[model samples]
Target: MDGIIVRRVIPSDNSCLFNAVGYVMDHDKNKAPELRQVIAATVASDPVKYSEAFLGKPNEEYFSWIQDSEKWGVVLTWLLLFYSEGAIELSILADYYGREIAAYDIQTTRCDLYGQEKKYSERVMLIYDGLHYDALAMSPFEGAPEEFDQTIFAVRKDRTIGPAEGLAHNFVKEQQRKRSYTDTANFTLRCGVCQIGVIGQKEAVEHAQATGHANFQEYR
Candidate 1:
């Protein structure tokens, strides 16, 4: 990998994880909800395979909540292994927060189960800073920074670069510096109708209902 670059998705949405996965997989962000449904249904339909201990919730309830847009989490890496009958490599940015955490890797290979064997190739990198998720990409760069191409950032699971441990450390440090002067007293939510700023999710939703504003954006 030479002169790698990371392309960031739009921020401040509860769907960051799904959107990040979609961006890396070359799918529409809107498809995330559907993918979530498929994962949930797959788990629900076969509770014996995806045991309660693994799912961490009752099959039906977990299935319903996972499909909700506001629910922002995933057990897809495991689910994908079962769905595709293949392998998956998940690389996580461990020290994204101001903490000393060990960077780790999870490799899940297809196993002989139900006498079903299929072949597929998929690998994904997810960047988590304890709160948000983002995708990463690296490619050769020869053009000016301003004129750098975006298509080059598409997902390429088969290709990988360095561990980039230094990059993770430096990014956390920069975030910490920015936080020192940032006032994060309350989560801000902006109404879509009148564009009024409200604090807290409950209050924001109440204000929206009262003012006939159904849309809102959250800023943390």
Candidate 2:
């Protein structure tokens, strides 16, 4: 397909960000643990670079927290349950791979480029719909299998950013028109365990604290 870009949806298993990065960088979807370890090791190696003020926690604490993958059933369940990857993880992985990582935000239709000033020669892309992350790739044709996807593009050739931004805007706008995202702030949710209703993440968290219900299904 001529300039066809596609959003490859990664599983929303709390490791979606890592999985998307893995897919773009190595064409692998299961490198979350390995990537998490990389972030932890990088942070540990340079405490001064990744300080308490920068990480919003002590360097050691941030590293430890990033590496732990325990789910909601554990004691630190609340933190783990709501943990979503942001700038910190992106910067670490971008430097580790020596490639610029561009995250196209659907809500704002803006590109957040990590390693933007590093003069990386290659670039990879991801689509962010507020809560989840998905890889952006150039497919050989429309509806092509992901096995045939081309993710990494040459920055020197100008093969990545401009084209990706245009296609991403189209994709993001279509998704917006379809209402394919959760507002998180105002969306209604029903507790999957007890079928009780709650509004927004705040209410859901409060309900979880009072009733020990962790499973929730978003609804209209």
Candidate 3:
């Protein structure tokens, strides 16, 4: 591995994926909207190729939804990787969901709409934590760059530091405590059918059963 440094992008309004991609491409965060449009257009043009199984919605509807500044998921991940490969002519290695870093190679069996094959010769890396994204850049270190298996490094189980583990544990505990407190607090459920506010789960359930209003949203 070379002295590859991971850079964090500033948190945006749930636009981490866009920010991360922009940072890696040496572009401003504003590029996210354009990138989203590109991806939407690509999917829209060839709905059969990038079908509902990957897009998670009807093609046009999903395209409109993804254009908004929101958190992206696996669908956008693959779309962005494919788009970047074509745009920049680089194979991208994405560290996804803190589980695995997979490489998307454009120089592979990627067939285009016209059934044309294209190939790229460069590679880059991006990091994802199932919530946010970041970029990784490699530069000259003090010593020589050591060759290592990227697959092993990507899913290494022993990579978590002790302090990181402790902090993660504490964070989970805190979240649990907060959830418990919230659960105990008074909650109002608004029925989707009748639009009536019912207090408490028991009352809400009873109301739903009585009125056949199965849909509800919780309010504090």
Candidate 4:
């Protein structure tokens, strides 16, 4: 996809997107109001985008980023209205770029570029307050994937063991430990649902075959 920057305008920014948004605002003093209306209408048409951008995310994928663009547009337009009040006039964000950069007064004032390991680009913010603090930059991926659990299938893939022999220990002791003693794929299943790569399918079939014979007994 083509690379594009999304940001608010601020003092001394020299970036293309910053200047473009700032120029638009300067030409039409009421452009902020119009931008807001456009944003509201656009957002109304696509609520998913608004929600994804404002909130952390619906998921860790590009679709979420694209959906959030609508809300980003709304914030950008709203920020332009603050030019008179010295509020952050713009925030520059590039969805395609591995890194993100922002500017003040048409100049690249602040830039955040990570090492090659970064999966996605960062967000650039604008601050118009006279206090001279840095424009707030927040990473969406931060504090994500807090909960990582393995399923029953995952265990079998990790360790070369079948459910029957492997389950002997558990059946004898009937102990349940819900912690990752090994890697994500190797950990023992805490329960039936959590069994995975470690447990072979043959064991299950053999057990069923041995136990089969219609053992159903109805109580009167």
Query: Where does candidate 1 stray beyond 4 Å?
Result: 73-122, 139-220
Estimate the lDDT of model 2.
0.77
* Residue-level lDDT for 25 in candidate 2: 97
Candidate 1's residue-wise lDDT over 36-115, tens digit each?
A: 66566666777886665555446677678667776552222122223321111111111111111121111211111111
Rate residue 218 of model 4 by lDDT. 13
Residue pairs whose backbone atoms clash in candidate 3: 1-146
Candidate achieving the largest lDDT:
2
Q: For model 3, how does the per-residue alpha-carbon lDDT over 184-209 read when each residue is reduced to its tens digit?
A: 12457677577898775556656755
Please list all clashing residue pairs in model 2, or write none if there are none.
Answer: 1-140
The lDDT for every candidate, in the order shown, is 0.42, 0.77, 0.42, 0.26
What would the per-residue lDDT of candidate 2 be over residues 10-48, giving only the tens digit for each residue? Answer: 987778888999999999999999999998999999999
Candidate no. 3 TM-score: 0.43
Q: Which 10 consecutive positions of candidate 2 have the poorest summed lDDT?
A: 71-80
User: How do all models score by TM-score?
Assistant: 0.47, 0.77, 0.43, 0.22
The TM-score, computed over Cα atoms with residue i paired to residue i, of candidate 2 is 0.77
RMSD in Å for all candidates: 11.9, 4.6, 13.1, 25.4
